[model samples]
Target chain A: MESEKAKILPFYVLIDVSASMSGDKLDQANRIMPQVVDALAEAPILADKVRFCVIDFGSDAQVRLPLCDVLDQHSSLPSLTIRGATSYAAAFRLLRSEIEVNVKQLKADGYLVHRPAVFFISDGEPTDPEHEWRTAFQDLTAGFPTYPNFVPCGVDSANPRTLATLIHPASGPKQMQMYLMEKGQNPADAIAAIAEILISSMLASGQSMAQGSSGMILPAKQDLPAGISAHSSDDFV
Target chain B: MAAPEEGPVRPVPEGKWQGYVEPFVVGDPGRAAAGVVPLPDESAWDRKDTVLDAFALREGRARIVEVRAASVRGLAHRAYGKVRQDEYGFRRTANGRYLVVCVADGVSSGELSHKAAMIAAKGGARWLAGLLDRTEPADLPWGQFIRGVAVMIERNGRKLLRGRDDLDAEKCDVREVAQRLATTVLYAVIDLHAVDGTHAVHVVTVGDTSAWVLREGGRWEPQEAVKNDGAEVFSPTVHALPLPPATEPVPVRTTVRAGEALVLMTDGIGDPLGQGTGPVGRFLADVWERPPASGLEFAGQIGFARKSFDDDRTVVAVWPVNGR
Candidate 1:
């Protein structure tokens, strides 16, 4: 008999590819994806535990990079291109279905799947009606077995209250975190910070597993980039 | 000198039992092949532990049981140049009526947790041994015993902090100091007295350190369910030592017949064992049907390489010696 399947942590990076993110912001986004992937590639032990995925959302949402073993793939992530509009509803709906399908497939493959973590980076609020996006967000979160740890990172022109609302587990100990750029801080720098957050969180979370703990460990508040401020949903409450 | 005359070679029997098969590595060896570069501790006065510590043999037929134990640095720790955070110890009462064994894994976040593991395994085992000598097993107050050990850890931890020149020990918050030296423990006591030729073993555990009974003919039976089996989301949150208020050790009681062995280990070995049906468990079950010829061999068996299961591995096995 062989050993039981090793545990895995699935991480989804959702980049808003709307018109608002056109120009320098989109370039920064494209540049960071490869850097983040390369960072994980360098640390094979941490890479072994992480399953990386890239999702792009505009007027519609699509799986730009399917959930995969970043270490095994050894392929470059697709560059994000500007698309229709910022549709939070599309992102959440697609995320819900993707998580449901991905977690099921991972389980079938004999890997012990951990709760998925979705890092949502946006420069603007949802283009759809408040109720429509909220319904989609609720579907992505509430009463779902494989619901994700939603980390919403809001940059230039992005509404803090809206990003706060996007946080899953709105009022619990395991509540999701929100990050925003400080006033006048360059959005490109914020993108770099997001890259840092993504890589650090992946390493920290993987290290936790290596240490025999299975929790998703975020980087400390002090470790956040200078231009970025972290908050829980409570600030909005 | 004249050579002796050569004799005719006899054909070996088909399907006959062969000699010992050494434990082999599986999957990626990772950075373990690069070898170790010792990591320096922040406090220079505090020296790091040896990377590997395995007794060739620590067997004693005290009353009815024979004990064998070993502790080894994990490949991940070795690759990272970190000291082995796992420790194990065994003690026998003066009257030789009982034997106590302890295994502890220092929580990784705590820099000084390696010392905590040492205290828990060695200090805790010694304390438990004395307690057994004074009190009857049935009358033992387990909750009080655990709390007493917690107090012992705090006292020893304070002494460790005070020894450091960098920090003011008295100014440090007591709770934070305790947290910095957290470790999980599993303690087992074998009742030397035999009831119908079977010895009773009492096990108390906090966190994920576990115990199993390996029966004759290669059957591995986990004493209790510690890992969450078949759960979609596995939380690594463990309840470690210097435990919260009202925390009680998870207790398990079982009998070990002669030829059967009771084994205690940390999650480094338990996570890989998973319900004792995997390759790791199968290998262990096959190799440990009888006590290893030496503790070096026992440590080798405990440190078998399996993919993605690298963590500090420590084990203490108590086998009941027949007719002892």
Candidate 2:
């Protein structure tokens, strides 16, 4: 009975809420976010180890949803408001601080915290030209056990180079790496599909960590639109 | 009264659907007892021997106890058949000179891993027993022994294929054959020759499956383990025998105090206890405080609902009683 206490794997989704991602992108993000939580709720075994959160970024980013235990998280995600510009630094800053607070609360409640995973989605370039995102990203990847598996997913016009930086190669080899979604015929439908795949990967990675895996084992990649591709930094570089 | 299959029997299982092996079912919440039932004996259709229950033996100075079981998902996932891919073996020589213990885990993705897992668990113990029967005791080259086990797995796999006619009758895919039987090896030997209440042990391991000696000082380090700083993020880091990219095993030897205990387990138990995946900050104090138990009663202890667990769990915990 002593081993019955659950292990918590906090998963956060960072969705770009800038003007560029307003119509089809925002609709898909809003629609597909609930499915991620539902997938966890459906599988009790997987649900036991996972906690969910959502961060929406533009001129600023804030937690659209708090860290909700997968088993106890019944409500759907709150609709994200359209913000001014794509601010990569704002997203990273919100994520790092929110994770620190979430993880602390989880441990205080007697939960064993697995490494966190951040699933980020964006459609445009960073508005913060000061390269301030790099500083905040460094703080996110800093030492002392709050490092998260940063998996950035690119959609319609999102710069692959900036998306690549989200993976933080200097940190070391990562589990949930990065992916580029296809600019398919329908942007809304394509974004929704990519969201589904990302959520599935998050569930699989969380389950693997609980089972003593190396913390970032991704689910097998299903055949995707020919336009999509994958990239991973060797040794987290 | 079916005795152990005598002589050099065909290593390959009789036809997949032809044999009278006990059938296993997926986990059912409505069921009152454990879905797992041990085979009656090592015979056709008997459930007693197949059940991975607890087994224990006490020698002059040390006591060894082990429990092995199928993963909760593997037990519940009714894809083809519910079979366990974890195996373990223990043997003490007649002269009481050495005690050998080993554990192995078949890759979940492997096709014929249940059979291969049994081979791995016993292969090391068998080698040490046979060597003792022929040669005199001396400082064993621990590296040579692990490397030998890896080579033996590759050879015996071919021999088993040769023993069966089905392979010759219909060509089986060669790559699939190796992939289907992949498994991890953690082999160990402990000297019974205790002088002034201490015993020397040699351990060699491949992959993430681990072994640790719990010192009486409330500290623990893996037996023969190089420090893994958590830099490697790959999931399947196992150095399986005879598989591609064969990496050589490194062995380490250490002397243990009388009150110390040894823990050998597959990733199922190792990861959570050691917190390899993340920081197990809470309830660290409440983990495994009581002394070990005797029978299948230990099975209940392992079956508890740990958050980050649910694989084929196998553990061998040894305590040297006389040394204390």
Candidate 3:
């Protein structure tokens, strides 16, 4: 029998907009928005193959862009407006719904899909309520045979333990990276880097999908940025 | 399965379609993956048949998993008659999942270079899929799979050359035929079985297309040695080479763990950014360090680099999260 031919990858960018990200954090993401869109346009593969979405969470979670291709509607990407507490649980629940709808749509259209990716960017702990974030995360992952790729990026202000839990079960040696965005550093530069990494990861995921491959591996600690540091899961809470 | 057909697999258009013309701007601000070109409905080209329509249909799934893909006649002008080739697919198997992603730049030098690229893409996808299905995930004979894929391509090329009636000596020569269809294939297979709790990543690759991983602390590092930055000699672009003889095979593998992200991409990422580990590496590092932005934001960054760097780029990321 002819094996399946297409793989669908859904990328959700979940940004934290708590009060802590008020200044440079928010500004950097805004400045680098156009550049990120431009990168996808130039790459025909990403331009053609990937569907993208954005969700911003602070007091609550909001969908910036539902599953859409950046190559087609670059200008439509939602603008970021920061204000409120970090409700990570609400954000995860929202992401779960978005992923389900998009995955179904993709399958109905005859595309083979891999698991969706949730890129969680945060600068603080969950101030909304305890265990809510954990419960939502668990419920979302419960249905899948393998866990979806949920990546957590921690800004300097973020609580390491909270970030550790975001990357859960895989904590300790497998904890997420802590991005040390020093004071005065251009937020644009960080945004640009984030964009590049997302695009690169999306592209890489597409490449791996085509090859019938599973998850790609992470780089060694030495290979990453100098300021970024990895702490054991115990270091968090 | 059915026997090989004697005629052309699919019909080629007799003449160019009169599609709306848009400037092939490398770094234009408003370009998106698959949006309407904001014109009067009547003025717009048949939206259904356009490349953007196909993209819209598949974008969601394409973003999440490994899947076969193709893009043609959009970015460049028709005068050059360029047809972009892209194929991506992923399958989770018994031993592991196989991922294949590649962009074939048909030798612009040949009469039917574009055709060759399309064929390579279709044939390659079919061949890889078949091989993955046949091989149990537990017995992922990497070398054997690579050889089988190459053989399938050669075999398909011969069939196409023999069947095409429009081609004469210049285009029909088998050796020249394969040469004209030159493409760079970058494939990676991840063995989840190899994931023994600790971080272990196995990646196999050929040509300049790259494989990388992002660890804790948001550090982006290369998984393969496509270039030697140690000597300060950076050859960032993936080097596409002639496919080795059917008897020989090339494949590399690595193992990865939890809390890590894996990435793979085509060489179209371009120079300066593509040349060394620094630009792409740093770019990814920053992305990992920061919070997750929207896909539009991600595309904006990639589009900026493409315009500034001037190359067709593609990147993919895979991160393993804790189940509970």
Best by DockQ: 1
DockQ of candidate 3 compared with the true complex:
0.01
Which stretch of 10 consecutive residues in model 3 chain B shows the poorest summed lDDT? Answer: B49-58
Segments in model 2 whose C-alpha atoms lie over 4 Å from true places: A1-10, A19-28, A66-68, A73-79, A96-117, A123-191, A203-237, B1-50, B53-83, B94-97, B107-116, B134-138, B157-183, B190-262, B275-294, B318-324
Q: Report fnat for all candidates as fractions from 0 to 1.
A: 0.37, 0.12, 0.01
Candidate 2 residues B1-324, lDDT tens each?
111223343457656543352222222221112322222212213211223334434554445322222222222122113355667777776676777777787776654555666676777788776676555435565557666765666566665666565464125554445565667777777776666877777777766667777666445556654323333122345666546335555566776655566667776566555532223213221232223342343444444434434456676656555522
Better DockQ candidate (1, 3): 1
Q: Best TM-score goes to which candidate? A: 1
State the DockQ of every prediction. 0.35, 0.12, 0.01
Report the C-alpha lDDT of model 3 over A81-197, residue by residue, as the tens digit.
986999989998888877777776665543445556666777777886677778888877666443456767766566656676666336443233333334444544554455555
True contacts kept of 3: 0.01
Model 2 CAPRI rating: incorrect
Deviation in angstroms for B179 in model 1?
A: 1.8
> Whole-model Cα lDDT per candidate?
0.77, 0.60, 0.50
Q: Give the higher-lDDT candidate: 1 or 2.
A: 1
Candidate 3 per-residue lDDT, tens place, B1-324, comes to 111122334555887454342332232323233332322223223321112101111122322221212232322212112333333334344333444333444433333444444444455545555566676434556566555555555555555567566555334545555554544555555443334453344454545556766667656556656442322111122322235534343454455455566666554442223323444455656653322333333334443322112233444445443322
CAPRI grade, predicted model 1: acceptable
lDDT, model 1, position B131: 88
